[model samples]
Target: MRFKLRPSDDAFYEFFSKAAANLVRGTELLNELALPGADVQSISERLVEVEHDSDAITHELYNKINTSFITPFDREDIYRLGSQLDDIMDHLEGVGSLLYLYGLTKLPSLPREVHEMVNVLDQQAKLTADAMPRLKSMKDLREYWVECNRLENEGDRVYRMLLVRLFSGEYDALTVLKMKEVADELEAACDAFEHVANTVETIAVKES
Candidate 1:
């Protein structure tokens, strides 16, 4: 251990960020069933896999946050950041679970559109992770975070349009409901990402 080392606050942000990236990858993997031979089994199996991955990262980050003597922001912010980042993975897990529970043997192209939104969420997570260190300079990166918010807003737009398309579709009520549930979760995950961005921005202001 070096004496008088600088505190590394971004670890809290970075660990959860791996958690976030896996969440998007998990969604994309499942959504790949939008093609052939992709069924409920694939979704369920992937869900379990991602759940284990996400949970491990969350626990590790939580431990790091609690044990570390230094963080750039308040302890509560650290906790909130970890939880919110983990939440995106949780939402993706929910989507996979719903696929199994709803008995959706086949995937649809429309949900793929929302999956595209996950890519936006991916960018949000990256921006957030990048911006946390910016807390060291987060003041200078407020506009950078605002851009992440814009991505979240775009996610909101995609969710709304997906819902509209779901209702307009020829699918049955249960199908519509399942689609709605998936979209809600994806949208909520994106919202949670925005919350992380907002938290980062706030921390930047207070620290600066």
Candidate 2:
């Protein structure tokens, strides 16, 4: 067996797992939008709270990276993973805030495709949360990143369909504009999840 020398800092892994779990919370809030008579304003407020929590976790991770003489992985990879995870939360918060700000909740219901995007995000978040702890062993990660990439592709297809519906004149032009903004954020969040997976794959490769 090949031997390797590295610091035994579990804090780095703990931070990643916490950040990822926060993402799961963020996506769960987005899923709440699909409920009948959902409170968009309340969901937006909660998303802000979750986003702030993610930011705090990322800050702590960065400080830990600076202080630690050795890290679980490359220092840059840790930072990138943390930043990308925070980006996903930002996009989730954006979706909630835009829906409330544009009064889109007043519509009878959101497009089916919007919920589809949320479902994709929810899957991605759960996958990332499951994979983060696996970083400790760097084993069985291929399946995680593979599944994440597949989900990202699925999200892209759903996103394209969402745009098609938005531009099909099903609603007034103003409503379409507002919804497109929300759609962009959802798509960005999906992409951000993929970025995190890609970073994980990179770190796994390096440490192998």
Candidate 3:
């Protein structure tokens, strides 16, 4: 029995980069919505566009996977990457929808920190994207993946603090629920980013 190694595709890496960019852009827009008197609906529409673009990239990648005789890494890695990337886009879109659904004309006092967390998460997302193309050079890229992990951990800390603030707030039940939902969406996006980092880490290990 023989195990076969496959050559990596430049296209796959590019698609991965686009996925990362979508998440970063979506989160950046969400943070922008925090501006006083900001037009959230307009920003939400942009997020919708970002989500759609991510879907297109994922679809293209899957099509490539089907036609290729072999994948650059494990087929499971490719699948996980696609799904996790989609997860980020979906969660970001959900956050955008809530802006309209909750009719949240203004950012809650509590979510202000969460928006900051999203900014950091966006940076992490972009860093992860940068590192994806460097998967072949695992030894060199290890630091980037580590930094991404730390940034995600920062997001978790912010989430915990936000939760505390939400529950302790003087808001009505409905407002609290709305705030919680948005905060969770932000956390979910960051969690998806962590998934990307983990997937990249796994790919590094498997390929090396």
Candidate 4:
């Protein structure tokens, strides 16, 4: 193990935790837009604000990385974790953008599978946020990454089912295309969360 003479900066952890909180807000707003008679434009506006806030947090994190001589974990891990978290928010914002751009009046009673996928995104964001504070000790963090892997796997199965239904003559070709786009964004968001969890696990192992 490489020993550090200087104390590592811990501000990155606080930034990460703040970013995760913003991500949860983004997902929650996206999920709200999925409800009946939801104001898609208004919710998208709110998400835009959340996305901007997250971008600011990300900028601060990278600035910290560049200035600090010592980091709480590996430098590349810091970059990847911050980038993945930003991607999750970006995709959540994409979901809202698609709703408005597609002129979808209301998400037709989304299949249970699709709802489950959104639920997983919400849970994953909150779990990641909760785990960020534990980075100091790197203790009891295995469950977070393990749960992330399981949720990503579950999201994959649901995504496949969604595609099959999209092509099964249940929706017109145009409608199928639009719904598929939304599903793609949601799946990408879940994948982003999994990537964050993987990075955290790697950092923990190295630090431990």
Number of backbone-clashing residue pairs for each candidate, in the order shown = 2, 0, 0, 0
Against the unseen true structure, what C-alpha lDDT does each candidate score? 0.71, 0.93, 0.79, 0.86
Model 4, range 158-205, lDDT digits (tens) per residue?
Answer: 899888888889878898889889899989998999999999999988
Better of 1 and 2 by lDDT: 2
Which residue pairs does candidate 4 place in steric collision? none
Provide the TM-score for each candidate, comma-separated: 0.77, 0.98, 0.90, 0.93
Off by over 4 Å in 1: 1-6, 9-14, 105-116, 126-140
In candidate 1, clashing pairs total 2
In model 4, the runs with Cα more than 4 Å from the true position are: 1-8
Better of 2 and 3 by lDDT: 2
- The per-residue C-alpha lDDT of model 3 at residue 39 equals 82
Task: List runs of model 2 lying over 4 Å from the truth.
Answer: none
Q: Which residue segments of model 3 deviate by more than 4 Å?
A: 1-5, 107-110, 136-139
Best by TM-score: 2
Residue 174 accuracy (lDDT) in model 3: 87
